[model samples]
Target: MYRGTDLPSDGLIAVVKRDCPTCVLTAPVLGDFVQRTGLAVYTQDDPDFPETVPGRIDDTMLDVSHRLRIEIVPTLIRMRGGQEMDRTYGWDRAEWERVSGLTAIGPDLPMSRPGCGAKNIEPGIIEKLKIRHGETGLASRRIELGGGEDEIEAMFDRGWSDGLPLVPPTEERVLRMLSGTARDPQEVIGLCPPDLVPATVEKIAINAVMAGCKPEYLPVVLAAVEAVLDEPFAMHGVLATTMYVGPVVVVNGAVRRQIGMNAKGNALGQGNRANATIGRALQLVIRNIGGGRPQEVDRATLGNPGKYTYCFAEDEEGSSWEPLSVERGLPQGKSAVTVFAGYGLQGVVDQKSRDPESLSRSFATSLMAVQNVKLAPACDVMIVVCPEHERTFRTAGWSKQRFLTRLHELCEISGEELISGAKGIAEGGPDTLAGKMVKKFRPGGILIVRAGGGAGMFSGIIGGWAASGARGSSPVTKEVKT
Candidate 1:
């Protein structure tokens, strides 16, 4: 089990076995030789075997046996310090004599195979592993900001970022952003996952700035960092999953207007800085502090563009129903952000439907399709109902609960509709929309909100596979900064 280098400068021979008659018979002679030569003697079954021997032995010997294919009894091992120098099995008297030579064991011996002997590792390989293990004392490494462009590029080339150009986080910039918030820069926001590195407000602001966020967006970013670190969120799993899940930020209250976030037409698309940067800022924090870079530990397959930026405001003014935050029991007029690890948007456009029932039916039919069924029924969904559709629902005198109830009823399908004949689908099932929906239907899975422009009769659905069950989807609300 011992590597050769783990041994003392002066070599020692250790005989190991548990309850073996041969070992018992040979103990006295071995003990005398050990005492005379001042060599270390170790027994496999001795209560204090590691202390008595030059080489340590434990359960790891079993691991070593598996690696080296050792399957014999009465093993005699030679060591210096705690490393194995040489080993022999089955009590070969000639081999024992050869190992017990007066001189120290030479590296030329047949047993001295690279790591087998106490060879020091190459410095370059050791350094690489240290970096991979995050043992560079990275936390202690001063956050240097003034590296030249070449140096910055080198850091990127060395696989440090999430495949985008970074805004150099100068000390001045970080401090200026920190000044926007009341929290201490050194105060720990939370430990980012995969690496479990401490995320200070200073670090968060630096990343937020890197993500092109304005100073006022710092509070929302801070709250998001806090929410993901909440034990239930399991940021580690979310960050590491092979699924295309990324954080979708939903903003509410007066902050939406103050920050100039888009809740109107193409809110999920581009053209709004506040919406884009807020979500981008959180993602940057996750990448920089949380260590969730794509393709490394991130491991997302067919990752969504939302991985870039997915944040939008609730269109409270256009909505006929209550806002999402209020539905989750937050007080009216409270500014908050609801974050979800979604697989991106599923656009539900129905320009032909004017009646509430027709619109609801269209949405339900779209939702019961194959892609929507990818999510578990118990999972929470964010339904972005456009103003045109909301107006139609209001004109029909349908409450939000009524819409939710109808949606739940319509979303249900039979087992045959769910099967896609793909590897993910259930075996021996029909491959229809009704079958798919029925297989994964759960009541109260829809989360409705009013958003988008008055021009289109379109809405969008953001669905998830599972509810994260007391762990995920507990939307955290933080007051937006002025």
Candidate 2:
């Protein structure tokens, strides 16, 4: 055996994945070797591989896989004192005999079998691992505060805040925030747009601490971050566009009560810690971790106050309708967070409307004018039904589907009224759309959620960005799992 000076004194390590046929073929032989020589085994994929064996080290995160530069599974390497000595890949009986020094290691084994590709190097996994644990992991420059300097002022000096005093993210605070989940602190969540900086879990926790989020809010914040960063959400475009759009988050299921998020009266407006900070944490992630700052990466002409914080839980208990997450096809009772790219909230007031059809018509009337009265089929709308409005609909026994159908029907505009030369508005609808009752939203475009106080006959409309493809953002929902 060619023993290198750097080899670990700890004997040998066997790396394998059950999915590899070669690994499966070599497992019994390795088990035999383990009984004979006490071989240290690491399982990459299925931890239960070598079923009858014990003491299998898990390399599911691929940390050990990358450290050894493993390109093939079923790799047997001799090591001593943390240093590599000799290594062999696949199930070559002769090579195993040479490496393990075991005679007739596997009498029934085939002469040779090639190994499978290491899971570490497959597609996006390597890049993600590197970003998480490598030396070059964090790209942002660090800021050191002076002894006498106020931390808030320091944040202002560095332009690290969203024009408000932020909770200082000290090492202790960040560490405490990271305690909310068992995931590695350095695990990269995804890339933030605009600057396209990598958002690691630790970095997000740091921002979450700064956002005044409680430790329990960490999972929700993480899910919201994931929701927005999803490719379908088009977070990059949402931040870069001149539109008034920002992320609107709706929390559902057990997490709403677990985190004490306000899903009832004043849900959308304010006065809830979980609701407020959860949303704020995401914005801070984009601004600090993602490098999206107004006058910098973010170019919103007139951003709304919701930009500061725009998250609320659905008032599922008070409303007769199904929870937003349930309606969106998520399993009932599963906690989730849904993120939508939306402009500021436009209040839909119908104090006089006493019935479901009338209230829905009022909503359709107001929704028709979103972005522009003529912006039909161009954007989607999220209708937040207040408790009072929800009662009216429930009393009338109107399903969400029925209400949406009526709104879609009422949103159609006459072709002549929408065309270029009409209404003295140059940015008119196309001639091709003339004389047609163009639906305002696409099929299933209207999003509905029940929230707010029981007193007022008021609902809310959150206008969406452009259409739902590459040019615009589609809402994304992610289950919040601790």
Best by TM-score: 2
Top candidate, metric lDDT: 2
| Model 1: per-residue Cα lDDT over 1-482, one tens digit each | 44333334556545445445554444544554565565544344443543333333442233233223333434556655555677765554556566665333322334322112110112223333334334333232445535465756865765555567766664445655665678877779789987898998878888886777777778878877787776766677777877777777888898788768899988888989888877888887788777778778898888888888889988999566888888877888988777776767788989888788998999888776525454334466678898988998999999899998888887765555445554465533444444344524445457787888878887888866454445454444455543
TM-score per candidate, chains pooled: 0.64, 0.70
lDDT of 2 by residue, 245-352 (tens): 899999999999988999778888778999999999999999988889887878889878889999999989856688889888899899999998886778998888
lDDT per model, in order? 0.66, 0.83
Model 2: runs farther than 4 Å from truth?
A: 1-143
Evaluate residue 260 in candidate 1 and report its C-alpha lDDT on the 0 to 100 scale: 85
Q: Superposing all C-alpha atoms, what RMSD in Å does each candidate have to the true structure?
A: 21.9, 11.9
CA deviation > 4 Å runs, candidate 1: 1-155, 158-160, 370-379, 416-439, 466-482
